[model samples]
Target: MQSKVTTTKEKYPDKPITFIVPFGAGGAMDLVARILEKSAVKHLGQPLVIINKPGSAGTLGWNELVTSAPDGYTIGISASELFLHPLYGTSRYNYPTALEPLAQISSTPVIMVVKADQPWQNATDLIAYAKEHPGELKFGHSGVGSIPHVVGETFSKSANITLSQVPFRSAAEAVTALLGEHIQIVFINPGTVKEYVKSGMLKTLAVADANHLVDPVFANALTFKEQGLELFYGNQFGVVAPKEMPADIRARLITGLDAMINDPDFKKDIEAMGLQYEYLDTKQMQTQWIFENKKLTNAVQESGVVELIKSQKQ
Candidate 1:
């Protein structure tokens, strides 16, 4: 009897691809997804549907992505919290085994800002006040385990000050509280506060980055490192799929996304939105995921945020 031969054929993305944004509409993640949808659809030969599942510090959408079938039709725009969530004990699945990276889209560094009339002029003055009045200064962040929260905690550890934390539903909300004088400080992306900074409603004390930002709005602001605090923080956005996706399908998705990242119109839109356009292939993104996972794990542990989170829950 002759044995039957078998061959695996590739059929992918015949229908609309669902791109999950783990945040509400009008946020950075949502904006990124909407901006790329047209170009990505054109490149992939299918419509890219954006589904917002905002909650659990961005893990809700990630959970949706990981739980979906590994068919390359369902993917998500993930942020740094995807890795930090598991460290904070908020997620059941970890990054390494739960998701597969497709491409890194962009990154926006966090900026430390205060109300325009606040007394502190720069990072030095703020740190000095915080050091002298530990537990008196209130800093606002989007959520407990969000990148801005981690940035605040990291600043506390690096600067040796004990500042109080105030969590809001989103960065915009936190900035609103800051504007109302409900909070003394807020760590947020420049884009969210760009108009306010330009309008003189907010003062950017320093950026939590290693290098100076290219955005003209922050040209005069110094980095936290420049201010003598060895600290850096930012939000990195990327695409991820369910683990064990077919190799050919993953390659197709990556190719389409890579093209979208390099498109002139897409780049212009991202810059206009005050985001830095940076692209990383699948391999590079995987390396970044691992490196960031380790780096943030240490930061979270050392900052004692894990304990703080547990206490808050209690």
Candidate 2:
């Protein structure tokens, strides 16, 4: 049998590797990619270059990765929204079977959050109060088909509430809207705003993980299950390469990734950044990716996002 990875490694023993990031700088995805940049260099023996191709909700980079030569040299950082974006954007790119997973780094629970100064004390209070008010409660998201919007919608439908949903352009903008009291609740990454929670600016009501939110600050909050609701979901982040890459090369890449995730220093870096570190190497990543792909489909069907994208197609 031919040694694909060995051949590629021998051919370009010192060539720098490229890691494509399909999101804007300063965003959570970008931050995680940059962190990996610091730790991945030693493993690859050459410098790691990150390319930002933020458009079509991360489909542009996915498209680029699919078309690029799969010699184990090029890979992309794929995240939650990318799995669902093409279904909402008029993009011609998507989960082409051409992409292969190297590993999954971590998972973050979508937390229903409100300003610390807000009147609602927990998810129960928020849901109950909204039941009476209906459409009076407002929430913010990155946009119409964003994860936050979908989470809020699912939460509302499951909780039997009608909170209004608002869309923003970026997480920073969403945070501003939340801080200015423009929206009553927001679904946000737990890591991005941990400081705000620590500083008492944002109060987390519930985490859409299980029936509980483990953080001490949220110990008093009520989860959907506790409130007699049945909805739970969040986001994940991982690395992927083209499926055509030789199996040997793919294995080496995943092995290196597994080592990275287990590195104490790397684990500390992600934790310090307020992001959770959940490793799902090769097999697990493949399973998780497939599951989330179905979710994106279901979300599109329920949200009419795929139809919206089709209508916008030129």
Candidate 3:
């Protein structure tokens, strides 16, 4: 019988791999995909060609990915939207079951921020002010069902406060609202707010991670855990192929991704982009997908976010 390694070699031989990014070019996920392509080709012996398919909050690209041939030639960069979108009834594919987990590439925490002139100084103060004026303070997020939306909802539930939610087309737009004082707060990626924070236009209330981010701009910010909330929310980027991919091909892809994720240069480049290089093998990635889906489903159901999201879509 031919070994798995030999089988993968025979399958690919020299055909270039098609990599799909479920987002537009120049996003963090796209950058990660491109960074890995540089080193992954060296290990897999096939160049990775990136194709961006952005729309419907990444569901369009995900549909393209799961519907593609499961020959290991087409793979996509999966994000938190993989789980959130399905729960919101926006995606047709049941992500955890439809996609074969190859490997987890990177993860980044959501940083909650407010304009520098806001009265609240920390999460505790923010929660207090929110509780005292429930449904009065408004927060902005990238979209109705995005990670930031879920994080804001989860935070409100944990603190027993009700803050109005406003969804925008992107994080940059949400930040603009915050800067204009149109919103009291916003949850955004650390990298997006780093410049504003540096210019003293915004102040970070807390990061939704167990520990503060390592980036100098957010290194001093406290975490939700430190503030006595067991809240952690962030975006995870990974690679996935159709569920029926050949075992040998899946193994080969996982091996190449693992090697690229662990490379020193890869780590530096990812961190520079305000993303942490954390590698999870196939098994771990599968477990994470299941766990995250359950958590997100519960949060959306309990918070009535699903109804809110559906209303927004109409």
Candidate 4:
């Protein structure tokens, strides 16, 4: 039985692997998953078939991943949400318990943006306006308990201001609402708004990160700390699998993901999309997730988002 199990693990994936993307097609995560699929042929000697399972602010797909057979055949892409959703009691599986960290593919700084036509010029300008108007300024995010939503909350708390919160199904939808002037502001990754900023449709106020964006259009945007606010946060994208996946198979999958992420062409593709090519191996990924979880826990309490969400539900 032991030898049989060893042989089965050695054979590993005799067929195409199912790569589940916990978001809609054409979204950033989906695009990243497709890029990995392209690299899989070179690194894993097997094709990766992508399936979109977007819903419930990404919990649907994550639940799917958590429930899938603990074989190397099933894997999925995850973002900050993997550690975040469970905090708000949305997901049945938490990061440390239900999923095994693979390798992080990329990271991007979150930026505060508004329609270029709005009067606010920078983070200070927006905060001042929001202070006087209180809850009048509507702020949109991907969803409650999502990265953007938390960032927006943290920023509001740090700045001692108030803004109305609006939740959308996805970042793309929030961006669309901002474009249509349905919302006055949004906190999102710089890559998602790069084109809009260049086209003069949206203006970035501050980046909630330590470093400024490398892209020329966003290079001038200052960090929140630089603007006198003590807030820093961003999103990290990575792969994960069911926690009980066999060890040998898990090792094989990690090896493939490491090779695919480190490929020069893959880095180029990631950068071209305005995402930073930040790679973290399995152990490093787990450490980073834990670090983020600690930070987010504090933010959740300080921002009072839990109470706010509960009140809204009522």
Number of the top lDDT candidate: 4
lDDT of 3 by residue, 1-314 (tens): 56986765566636888999876665566777888888866778788899987667677888999999888789889888788887777789887789887889787889899999989889999999888887899999776778888788878878888888997765777888899989999987776677788889999999999988988878899999999988788888888888887766777777777887888888888787777677898889989888888877886788787887787788
Error of 3 at 286 (Å): 1.7
Over 4 Å off, model 3: 1-15, 117-119, 125-138, 157-162, 176-184, 195-201, 228-230
Clashing pairs in 4: none
lDDT by residue for model 2 (144-244), tens: 55566667877877677887777665565677888998887888777667778878999888777774544555556566666666556677888888777
Clashes of each: 0, 0, 0, 0
Worst-scoring 10-residue span by lDDT in model 2: 305-314
Backbone clash pairs in model 1 (N, Cα, C under 3 Å; residues 3+ apart or in different chains), count: 0
Q: What is candidate 4's CA lDDT for residue 86? A: 74
Score each candidate by Cα lDDT: 0.83, 0.73, 0.83, 0.84
lDDT of 4 by residue, 238-266 (tens): 99898888778988889988999999999
Instruction: List TM-scores for all candidates, in order.
Output: 0.90, 0.83, 0.82, 0.92
- Leading candidate by TM-score: 4
lDDT, model 1: 0.83
